[model samples]
Every structure is written in structure tokens, then in C-alpha cells.
Target: MCAKNILWIMCDQLRFDYLSCAGHPYLQTPNIDALANRGVRFSRAYVQSPICGPSRMSFYTGRYVRSHGSTWNGVPLRVGEPTLGDHLSEIGVRTALIGKTHMRADTEGMARLGIDPESLIGVQVAQCGFEPYERDDGLHPDGPYAPDPAYDDYLRDRGFGGSNPWEQWANSAQGEDGDILSGWLLAHADKPARVPEAHSETAYMTNRAMAFIREAKADGRPWCAHLSYIKPHWPYIVPAPYHDMYGANQVVPVVRSGREKENPHPLYASYMEERFSRVFARPGVRERVIPAYMGLIRQIDDHVGRLAAFLEEEGLTDSTMIVFTSDHGDYLGDHWLGEKELFHEVSVKIPLIVVDPSRDADATRGTVTDALVEAIDLAPTFLDAFGGKAKPHVLEGRSLLPLLRGSPDWTRRAVISEYDYSQRRARVDHDVPVADCRMTMVFDGRWKLVHVEGMRPMLYDLESDPEEFVDLGDDPACEAERARLLGLMFAWARNPANRITMSEEQIAAAYDTELDANILIGYWDEAEVDAARKARGDAE
Candidate 1:
């Protein structure tokens, strides 16, 4: 089969189970669900790392956190690294990215771990070889307060009074876009949608991407466009119509309460409490918040419908390889966490749909695979589809083209996700670093093992406790299972030699000793640093 145009639609912090195709009872993701019905859905898709930047970076590089050395955000992707876009672009595939490239940020807490700050935002989308046709730098749909006087007046019209810039504009309750930060305050009371057409971040980006797609089609180039939307991520915000779409009473609450003590990781319960309670800190808040989040999903679906319609309208449906997924899953109310960067299923699992135009409609269509796949597989998959090859480096992923073509034996037994925060903390109490933490995980088909550097590890039997309520790490009955998982962890640690040992000095030298120790890092800058570090090679 000839290589086809690739369109990867990625949503921010969306849980896999939130889609109707994935058995969600309330979500109205018809477009995504339809794609699932027409193509293949991998039920157990996971990211190489739980965090946003690292996972996205891994997806582009087809490498693990250890291989690419982009364990966190803010680290820059080195210039020469052969990313999916780089490979495809070099070999005649035109690539373009619009919307959120969380690939730009780095993990926040690297300073305390003695990791270089510049290395934090290692590999970014720009380095991955996409020409920046349009970029937002991850700004919200609700514009910042100071920039537009009209927006400031709009905020004042909505009676917003927060000193925080993000706080003032983020509330969806304050405006017609009541699902956002400012709109929330004014949602029921003021009804702020009077002025502008609720410019949804998700919808706007989708429209922009549609325009780009049209242009790409007219340009007559085999294109690869990535549209990464930034919601259902935080401060769960949708527009007027979407915010009211799903009923709170009907929305399933994340099953908590009884599961805390089961596989208790350090600060797990506390983290959940903080995550869930913060949104509802206001009285009767979740009733307003939860529905809006579902609304965002619906909104995403609505725009995706636009793309799907365009695909058919342009007669490109059978010629484009459309893929939909997320950087990671939002806990929503699961374990009370709203954002991602965790080991739990709700935080790690993502909805993945790949529609290969070349496959037989009945053979590769609407099929669901229960394989344990990782985001890293994306790079190799695109490489194969685009007539490129995976780098000879020790990559931890395999291509999915064979599975897309219905290969009977194509499956992954397990997958690994790594995270290293070690820096950003809530606050220092009793002289202990509040936020310093490092974690690694291994999840085979039925069992999962989470290893925290300074805390007791967590082991869960996913079959028996799908919600991950039981921590059977110390349970005598589970000793053999724990030992088995421990062995898996050891194997993962050993598979990548460079990650196993490296002094601070060594890492610094590998980075050309350019990274400073003081900067508060994020994923974008980390990519820049990591790209430089990788280029250093064995010179250090």
C-alpha cells in the first residue's frame, strides 16, 4: 500500500474511558467513536512517560525516556535527532503542527535533583522538524486580561475580581464560555456570552487546523498535520452549549474512598484530596464543573466532525491516515485529580484511534485491539507509513503498521512509563522537600508495579482492582507477583544502559556544560537543552 497523508489529532489530558467507543455511557464523542468504529482502537495505549512533554517527545522520537533522555518537560529536543516529522519531511512528506505543543516544556522540579535546568525542556515540536506555520505557545482561548482593553472591560462586565491573571481570565463561569475560569464566576449569575462568539480554544484550534488542511490539500503535498487541543486539561471549561450538555447527576464520579489504603503510594491520598477538592472548593462547584468537562469532550467531537466531514468532502477520506489520541489522561475526579502526570489508569491511559486509508474497510475497520502499546510506537509507525526507517538507537517501541494491517501476532505484552519531577513541590514542611519525587512504572497485561524512589512501592492487580484501589505490594499473598514485577522493573532499568549510570558532571558535560542550575524549568526549554545534550554524544 502507498503511504498516505497523516493527520494526528491530540487532545489535552483526556481519559481513554471518556469516549463512548471506549464504553463511556455519558460522553458524546460521535466523531471519535465513529473513527473507533471504522478503524482500530487500542484499549491499552499508554505514554512512554506520564508527563506531557516527555510523552509527546517520545512519540516523535520513537524512544523511551531513558533513550532520548527527555524524562521531563522544558528540555529542548536536539536539532539533529531524527523525529517522526524529521524523517517524514526528509523523505517527501510535508509536516505541519498547530495548537498546543506541550513538547516545548520541561518537568518543573529538576533543579533540586541536580539535573540541569536547560535540559528540562529538552525536545520540542519545532526541533521535531515541523515548520511553525502558526503557534500559540499554549495560551488559553480566553485572552489574557491586560492585552485587550475590550477583554478587561469584558472581565469587569462579568464582575471578575481575581488578582491572578490566569485566575481572572480562566473562569468560564464569568462569561458565555461559562466552562472557563472567568466564565465560571459569571456563568449562572451574570450570563457573559453577550459580547463575543464564545471562542473556544478547542474549537478555534480545530477551525485553524481545518484551514491548514485545506491549504495543504490544495498545495498538493502529502501532509502530516498535528492539531493538539488544550482542554479538558485544567479548570475544566467549555462554552455555553457544551457546559450544559451533560448532567452532573448522570456523570459518574471517580470511584474513590475505599481504595486509598490499598496501593498507597507516598502522598497518594493527599494528592487526590488536593486535586479533586480544589475545583469544588467553592460550594456546589462540581455540579457546575463536571458537566463542563464532558462538554469539552463533546466540543472536541463537534470540531472533529468538521475535520471528518472535510475529509469526505475533499475526497481525501480514503487517502489520509488520521490518528487521534492524547498526551495523557486527566484523572478528572478519579483519585480526585484533574490533571495528568500519574501512574493510575485514568492518568496514564489514552484513547488511540488509527485509520489507515489503505486497509480493507472490513478487515482493519472498526476493530479493537487489547495490546499494551506506548506513545513511542507512533514514531516508528509514521516512519514505516512514510517510507522512512527507525533510527538504530536502542528504541523501546515498535511500529503499528502491521497491527493496522491486521497482523495476528502483533501485540505488546507490557509497557513502561517513566517520570522524574524531583523539583517542584507544594511547600517545604519540617525541612523536607515537599514536591521532590521520582517514579518509574511497569505494567504488564494483568499487573502493575509503581516504584517511587524514596517511598514504598505500589503494586496493583488490575484485573481484580481495575480502579487500582488495592495496594498489594506488602500483601503476603502477592509476594510472588511482587517479585515478578520487581524483576520486570530491574529488566527495564538494565535495558537502557545510559540511563542506569551518569554523574551530574557527566550529564553537564553531555549538555556541553551549558545548562544553568538556577532556572525554573518547563518542557519547551527542556527540549532545547536535550537536543544540545544529545548532540554532545560521547564527547562528554
Candidate 2:
């Protein structure tokens, strides 16, 4: 029961119901499902944001999106923000990231504040606070067009000769005309990845993770390795057997129809008409892409099994807490949306499986819970699992230790997620100004509400309509419930720490010792200033 080791495995854009244990009809992800069987599968887990970078920042920092202020992908997480790596590292646990973090360093902040961008602290802040065992943010050779030389060097050392093998092989397919089909293009979604299965990014990252686990285990030091996989994300293509594993026949029926567009919610309708959403909704397009997406997930499941096997082989399974989750879920044409930006369940809800190798979790093994868990809860959970407490002044998330120990009820009744698309140039097709273009989601297990700035909220009764086709926001019968859910959303979003690091309590404590420096305007007249200073503790 001395398991202080944490193995956090995350897959990018994995859905909540894609595993067999989660009632997925098409995908038989037995490896991930087996972990669920041995642990607790949270049926209603959600992310703080429906995008990658912000969601992961929430996860790693145990802070809500507003508190951390890394609102979107490529948005720099503010410097000096505490993260799980910072907390765990202070407690003698080595923290490392093996795969993608989608983090961008705050160069502007660093330069403006005169902080050294090349310092160890600066790099840690830029990498979502994880030390690099083998840092690979999944963009290599060519992606989001970032320059990545680490994986490129690995490729060269392994005899994969090319200036950008990522584009040439890993993400490309060999066409019959000897042309290269770029996975970045939807035209090549059906093509198998030109990279050999062993050299695929997923495989290489998994190997790096295994090596890290082995190295850390040898030293017997407590460690948390974030074995993040980048696949099942985009460029929807896979290598070898996984590439041809499932086709359109294996894909679940499209969760949309002309009916959605008929009475579309203004925001929802606008998203459907966008170029990306339009392509996903187009006929034959999904048939070509979805299988590749599923294939990438299937490969991830295999790797999960491989890691589990490695743990058992090394006799570390008994002393390591394994938690599997995703930053967020992909829309994959759900509700006629292409990617995850909206507040749909397909974008915000994700699978959360936790295996706590402790006596307290024995009875809960293989049980499913409907607790409203957020991505931000992860860092606090890990901290609590290791018998450490979160710095109340730093982390804004509640720990899931009670749930892990089989608590019947939860402190939180609803989960919240949000997205700010104001900076993106994508057309909203709405009369609202771009600055006010944002979205938020609140799911209370039964009732779910989506609120968009400058627009009427979208509401759904999930108990009756789990797939969320019906919008009851303006429905007279649901008015009361809508008000209640919106109240919860408002209260949750009203945290004084939003766009702030210090909590009110923390601020009060810090100022409590500064009463001698208390100088106030308008609190007292100038004639009474001397008397006020004498009455207070500030008198010289």
C-alpha cells in the first residue's frame, strides 16, 4: 500500500463512450476497458474546457481555465502559476512529460518582465510544468508548423533519412502514383500512414514512457510520468493493421440529420455551416475519416495494454496508481460539428478511469460512478493519493479521494466547461461582436445547459435526451430547471480567483500581516489620519 508512483496516461480527443466498458458499440478497446474493470470508471467525467491546451492546463494545474488564463491552444500559461509538476517535485516525486503538452511559452510576459526565457523555471512553465524525460509535443517535422528537432534527430539516428520525415513518412501515405499523400489533408484520411508501425509517433512516445517508468522504478523514487499519446487527434490516419482495422461499417451511425439544421440553435447552426463542420457532415467524408480515427484509438488501447504488461513484468503494478483520461473529446461529426470547440458532450465529456492501488480502493474496484468530476480534479487527486495536500492558495480543484474510497455522494453536483473563440477568425455567422463570441457548458448529470455570450442559452434534458438533439432552453415547461442550472454555472464561474492566482482567503492572509502598511483612500479624512494610524497597529 506504499504506492506513491503515479502513471498518468492520457489520449488526445478520446470520447467518453468509445471503450467497450463505456457501451461503445463499435470499438472494442479491451485494454482500456480492463483498466476500468479493475478500477473506477467515472461515467460523467468532464473537462474544464473542450480544447486541448486549456483543458490540459486545467488538468496539470488543478485550476479552472479562468484561474490559469491559458484560454486557448497556443495561449501561453502565465508564468509563476503552480502546477502538479511543481507540487510533486517539491515532494520528492519526479514529474516528466513523455508526449504532447500543446503548451506555448509566454515569451511576451518573459520579455516584458525581464525573466530569462532559457532558464529552467521558464522552460518548466512553458512545458505545462513537466520536466522532459523525452519531450515531444506531437508536432514534429511538420505540424501546426512548429520546428521540432528532437524527434527529427531520433529519426535520423534510426536511419529514417529525411529533412522532414514527419510529413514525408509519419503523416504521409505512399500513393500508387508514387506521390505523397499528406495526412494533414482530409483527402488522405483513408490512406495508411507511410511511417512504419514501429516508428509511428504513438509507438515512439510509448517507448519513451516505458523507458522512463523503468528508469524511475530502478531508483525507487516516487515519480509521475505523463504518458500522453498524440494520436486519435487529427490527420486521422494510422499505421499497418490499425489503418485497415475498421471502416464505415464499424462506425456508429451519424448522430445528426437534417432535423438539427432545421431548427438549429443560432450558435449551433452557425457552427454546422462552417467549412470544417460542413466537410465532416458531407457524405463519404466521415466514411473515409472516422475509421482512421478509430484506428488511432485502437492502437492507443494496445499500447495501454503494453504498459500494463510492462508494469506487471516489472512488479511495479502493485505500487503504481494508473489513471487514464483525455484532455477532451472530439466532435468527429457529432451534431454536425467537425472538431471540439462547442460545448457538446462529444467535445467536453471524456472517459476517466482511475486505478488506485491501495486498500481503500479495493471495494470500489470495477465499479462505475456518476460523480461529476472535472479535469482540474486530477492534480489534486494525485496529490491526495500520495498523502499530500493541495496548497489551498494555489489549486482550485477538489480532490477525488472520497470518491476513490467509495464515498456515496460528491461535493460537486455539476461539471463545467468553457471555450473562448473570440480570437479565432472563423466566421460565427451571428450579429454578435467577435469579442463577445464565447461558449460555456454546465452538465448536472441529468440536465445540461450551453451558454454562449450574446445569445440565448441552449438547454437539454439529458436524462431523456442523452444524445442532446432537443433544445429546451425556451421551453416553458423547462424554464425553472434552466434557471437552476444557469444559477449553478454563474456561481461556479464567479470564483474570485478567475484571472487571478491568489484566492480571497490567501489574499486576506497575506494582507493580514501587512496591516502596518495599510494606507487607504476615502476611509478616513486627512485630519484623522494620525489618530487612525495610532488606533490601528500601524502606529510608529
Candidate 3:
């Protein structure tokens, strides 16, 4: 089978139920919902990690965070790790990245190996094996670690008229005093963004992606475009019409109450005490921010419609595979917590929709499955779609092509997610050591277990209390189930950790032993040597 074009769209911090297809009460999201209707939507898709950097690293490499060692944002993905781009390239598929990768280059690793950090090969190795069309990690000009210089430069060229145009024109808003209110300040969530809709980051990125598609199509090559958008992530503000699209009535009642604070688990109690988490619980905060959040999502949906229309108009719809998902989900105050990093459905459960235009996939069109899926499965799915052979030693994830085509059997029973808050330096300001500040979430449909390194375990009976209000970890009746789940986790942890996938020369050299090379002198003489060389396809 020949490889086809693949469009992998990742929206940042989008919640699972915020779309009409996902049962949002007020949000229509017709464009995004239309994809779900025409494709197979997995109801219980979970990310490998509930945080951005680690989760995306897992998605690109098709490996677990434990395996990749990039446990948080700003941590380097180990040099030489194979990614989706690398695997797709093996099948002659041209892979290009158009937006945020959250990749922190492995400078130390490159320097240690005497590799140039700015070289062509080094750039590809640093950016998760992707050939960059345009790389933006969504950091503003004055961002702490690194500024998105490209975005800032683009904004300035468009006559934004500000010293820091990225923050001033694109992300800030006019206050009651007619002063600029920066979106980075959480207090300005309800304000309208100062930038016009046409010049916004979302619009700019969509056009960039469209441009790449046009150029790649003209090259007459099979390609995959990673269209990653950073929005609804934070700074919760939108431009003009979107900012006023919804208001207080549109805000759904929060999923939590004061009851969760009563005798909360150690981790839960710690998170609730956080300033970010506490601020969301303040009166009027939810009402003020949800409108902008909804607006950001609305904008993403509209852009998705534009991309889909471009595919159809250019006659590329049937020749491309469209997969839409998020790196992780936003809590949106679901469990009295502000951000993602938990095992709760609100934080970990993401929306996954796959549209395979092949005739084999027609049987499952518009179907929704409750099957367990993970973000890591994306790489192997693209590999299968591109007719590439997945390397078992490299890719820990299994392909979803079988499941997407309506096969009755499943490849995974329990899905896993993990988080290491230790490296989240600012967030982990307490005296806790980094060694013991990690957590793993292992869940099947009926039960969920949160295994912490140095903290008490948390178990939730999803069948009985799906909202996870009660912790069954200490309950005597759940002891056997907990043991079973613990054993499964332990078993997974025992797997081999070898990273080397031997090269073709290494395989050939293994058979070119001294005895094999000297075999011509054995019994039959030089006559058999020529026959052996011909058989091995190395004949003169």
C-alpha cells in the first residue's frame, strides 16, 4: 500500500466535554463536531501525561515519559530518540511541523557528543525529528525561558506599533481606565484582546499551515503536517466578537463544591491549597473567564473548518488522514483544581477523532467507542496510515488502525498517564525532594488508581462514583482490586529499557564473523564462496 498525506491537528488544553459532540450544554463547535460525526471518536482517550511537554514528547516518540526522560516542560528530549517524523520518513512520507512542539533541545547531549547544535541534522534531532515549516512554542516576547522570536517578529512587521507587540497588541486588552491590561495577568480574563481577529495568532497559524499544505502538495510527495495550536491554554482572553459571544449564563455550574475539601487526600489537599487552584474557586471568577475560554475554543473550531474546506476544495480530503486531539485536557475547575496534572476524567480524558477515508474504515464512520486509548497511539497510527513498519523496540504504543476500522478485538485494556511535578520548580516550592514527587495514573473503565512515589495511594471506584468524590484506597472491600492493579503496574515497570535499535550494518556485521568469512577454506574450497556471496547479494 502507498502512503497518504496525514493531517495531525493538536489543540492545546482543550477539554473533552466542551464540544457539542462531547455534550457541552451551550457550545456548538460545529466544525470540530462535524469531524467527530464523520469519523470515529474515542470517548476515553487519555494522554500519557497530564502536562504539556511530557505528554507531547510521548506523542511524538510513541514512548512513555518514563522511557523518554523528558518529564516536564523545558526538560530536554534525549538526543537520537526516534519520533513520528523519523518513522514516517522511513516510509517516504514528508513530515513538517507548523506550530508549537514544546521541544527543549538537548544542548548538553549534543555538546557531549561533539554535535553542532545549529547544524541541519542537529536541528532535526533537537526538534523531535520534524522538518520545521514554522516553529512556535507560544512563549511571548518577555517570556522567562525563551521568547517566540518568530511570532514576535511577525507581529512587529504587521505594524502592531508597540515595544513588545506580542504582549501589547496580540495578548493585552483595554481596561476601564483605557490602559492596556495584559492577558498574562489572570485578573484580565474577561477583557477583550486588543488585536484584530485577522491578525491574531490563531489566524496567522492557520494560514501558515495552509501555505505548507499548498507547497507540499505541489512537490507531489506524500506528507504529514502537524498543525499544533496553542490557545485556551491561559491568558484567557479573545478578540472582538468572540469575547462577547457568551457570558455569565453560558458558564456551567462548576463540577465541585466545598465537600471535596473535607478530608481530602494528601495530594488533593496540597493542590487545593495552591494559589492558582484557590483563585478559580473565588466568586465571579468562573463566570468571568468561561466566556473567553469558550471563545478560544470557538475560534479553534472555525479554523478547523477552514482547514477542512481547503482539503476538500483542493481535492485532498480523500487522500489524507485527519486526526484531531489535544496534548492534555484543562480542568476548568472540575475538581476544584485549576490546571491539569491529575487522574480525574476532567483533567486527563481528551477528545480523539480519526477520519480514515479508506473504504475499509467506512464501517466505523461516525461511531463512538468507549475503548481505552492513549496519546502515544498517535505515532503508530500515523505509521500504519503511511504504510510504515513500526519498530517494536522503539515504539511502545500499538496502532489504532485495527480499532479504527471496526475490528472487534482491542490491543490495549488499561491506559496509563503519569506526571512528575518535581521538576515544576516554581510549583514545587515546598521542601519535598524531587525523587519522591511523582505520580502515575492507571485506570480501566470501572476503577482508577493513583500511585504516588512517596505518598498515600488514591483509588476511585469509577463504576459507583464516576465523579471520584470518594477515595476507596483505604476501603477494605477494594483491597483485592487494588492489589490486582498494583501488580499490573509493577509488571509494566519490569520491562526492558534498552534504547538501541541496531543499524543495518550492525546486523550484517553480526553474520560476518571470522568463521563465516573463512568458510571458503572449509571442505568445499573457493567454489562455494562465490555462490555464498551471490546468495547474500554481495557478488562481484
Error of 3 at 283 (Å): 0.5
For model 1, residues 1-540, the per-residue Cα lDDT tens digits are: 755688899887788888888888877788888898878899899987877778888887778877776666766554444567666776788787776565542234333344453342232333355654554434333432112222233345556434432344433344334434344341342222222224545655777788888899889878888887777666565556665677768577556555574545554654544534456434455566567677778888888898999889988888888899998986655565545677888888888999888754359788898888999888778777776755434345788888888787886657888877543332221123534456788899799988776666778898998878778766889888878887888887776734424444556676723344534354368677677556656455
Highest TM-score scorer: 3
Instruction: Give the candidate order by descending lDDT.
Output: 3, 2, 1
Whose lDDT is greatest here?
3
**Candidate 2 per-residue C-alpha lDDT over 169-188 given as tens digits, one digit per residue, 9 for 90 to 100:** 78888899988888888878
Clashes of each: 79, 0, 0
- Span of 10 residues, lowest total lDDT, candidate 2: 422-431
Decoy 3 TM-score against native: 0.92
Please estimate how well model 2 matches the true structure, expressed as its whole-model Cα lDDT. 0.82
The candidate with the higher TM-score, 1 or 2, is: 2
lDDT of 3 by residue, 308-370 (tens): 999999999988889999888877777888888878898888999999878888889989999
Q: Is candidate 1 or candidate 3 better by TM-score?
A: 3
